[model samples]
Target: MKSNKRIILHYDMDAFYASVEIRDRPNLRGKPVIVGTSVITTCNYEARKYGLHSAMSVAKARGLCPNGIYLKVDKEKYSRVSKQIKNLVLRLTNKVEFIALDEGFVEITDIIKSYLSYEVFAEKFKRGIFKNTGLTCSIGIGYNKLSAKLASDAKKPGGVTFIKDIGEFADFISDKGVKLIPGIGKKTQEILGLKNIVQVSDVLKISLQELRSILGYNRGEMIYEYCRGIDNRKVSSESKTHSISNERTYLSPLEDKEFIWSEFLNLLVKTHKRLKIQKFHTKTLTLKVRYLDRKIITKSKSMNITTQNIETLKKLMLELFEEIDLEKKIKLLGINLGNLSENKEYQLSFKNIENIKKERKIQELKEKINNFRKNIV
Candidate 1:
């Protein structure tokens, strides 16, 4: 069956941070573990079994698993280990792409053919990865990125699995939730429930238009193609994010205009810090908000010059936010920077030095805001 499923592999480290924490402290071996930058990082399988996950707050984590140990991320050490791991992976194939410090995708179909002893090859590769990085990863071998990712996840944490033939495809994925299909999120799943389609196999029977009308264009197309285990995206090679932005999901719904402005300021500051490090800029800042009942609204305007200053952008964000009447509390708020362009020095106008200085002040405030938010939640 000439399916679009490419010969791809999804590689993810098992409880990456927790494993690293355990590796460093042998004493932590038998205990449930948590390792993350904030409260949102890696939690051990034991904690996961208790319904705690990557993004859940630490306070919430403790409630679910009182015995779980928590530790802050040691990024410097992780980076050092990741570099060593990358070297070992390069031994397997030249087409390896590292998506983050711990996760990667390697295209190894040709290498698999060359090895002949694939299980031996897998074992050696696994050993090499572990010996070098002190991290255990799950490897999924499949016909395409999607299937391969799913396969890798079948057996986790120092586990490897293969998708040999398509006949067993249904069996492999039959018990999986529709949410695992990538495109079907919580909102979409509810929509699907209304329509009586709830499984990977169930998607095969829905008309494309029916899927499209319900999920919208890109997500619908993604479902239609992915159900057959087809994903054409390459190993997701590293690229500069096209735009930089930040958002806040209010701790609780908020309607206070002043409080909302303060939140926007904080976000702008954080986003500016990231933009500074990446050496990128955008031509526009977009302000977005959602109401308690799930009503979303957005506004955007282009800047005359490229900048990522928090103070400058906050003025714009507040201007946009203020335009919306706030009789009700806001459930979610976000900011987006778009119309990206590489950095270039603009010709400063002498006719408007005060205006230029004021503009520069906005940029400076953005820088300050970014710095201030670094240690904040």
Candidate 2:
């Protein structure tokens, strides 16, 4: 019965941003190294000892560990390293879903069949990552994604944990708090606490109908199934891109409207270029602004028709930007072109015929410019 279960592996890099910094600068080893500016993105285990963690305010972290070596995030360098690690895992199996820059789920049901055991394959995978990237990751193996993720987080730095089947998973989490279950946040916990439902075992006592009544239909049903260590979510290796976006975080907050608008325009052009290259026409434009206080606000607008025209997109982006309150000094600005469609003829309108023709001509000219630029480079 245990052999019939699907084998899912979840791999998470230990203190990803901090680890990369330490790997590059060996002097940072054995020190409390922190990453990010406004908030803590990640920190080494040494920094965690001082009660510092991701999302904690930089001011709070400084108060906790005044002597910690704080550093800004280098996303481009980290992305390059992430791609290298991803390529290595792809060699083992193409069935990988990267959930974040430093963590992902890989279905190794078929791969382990060729090996002696799941443990053997996990160990080999971990060693391969370290050998190539000089970074350590924890691997968790289980019958489903939920268990695999939890198992990986149970051990830190360099650890491999395997939960063979549903029975083992149930027993393992039986005594743990309901918050241990993914998606059960503070509000949900508060709701459950009102009913004295605090632990996995406590949830097991409630009837399916009762749980449904408590948490609403969909969420309640999902929680009821999860309490029994039952998860039917499949691992998807989706290659199709759904959206294109670009953003910039400033070293100092900007209060000038002209300067901020100029920065946003640059991002919009870059994102539109990528959209055109991918042959995707977007109908929606979104503007994201993060203020000096770390509060984020976003506004979105959808055009009447899909388009690949940067001019039309620029107009829409400006409309969305105007909807946001720019009274506060901003630290970050971003643009996201979404509601993407690869099929160009999906939403053709006779009213926009003239505009469409103009867009096509502009696209052709842009392509020529891009080709010429590439040749010169």
Per lDDT, the best of the predicted structures is 2
What are the per-residue Cα lDDT tens digits for candidate 2 across 1-377? Answer: 34666989999999999999999999999999999888999999999999998999899999999999999989899999999999999998889999999999999888888898887898999999999999999999999998999899888988989887888998799999999898799999999999999998999999999999989999999999988888989888985788899988887889888888889899998999999899999989999999999999889888767789988988887777778777888988999999899987765678677777888999999999999999999
TM accuracy, model 1: 0.71
Instruction: State the weakest 10-residue window (summed lDDT) of model 1.
Output: 1-10
**Per-residue lDDT of 26-92 in model 1, one digit per residue for the tens?**
8987788887534658887777887888888888888888877878878778787777777778777
Per-prediction tally of clashes: 6, 0
Model 1 misplaced stretches (Cα beyond 4 Å): 1-6, 36-40, 72-94, 206-210, 213-218, 238-240, 246-270, 286-299, 308-336, 343-377
lDDT of each: 0.76, 0.91
Clashes of 2: 0
Clashes of 1: 6
List the pairs of residues colliding in candidate 1: 6-143, 269-369, 269-370, 309-366, 310-366, 311-366
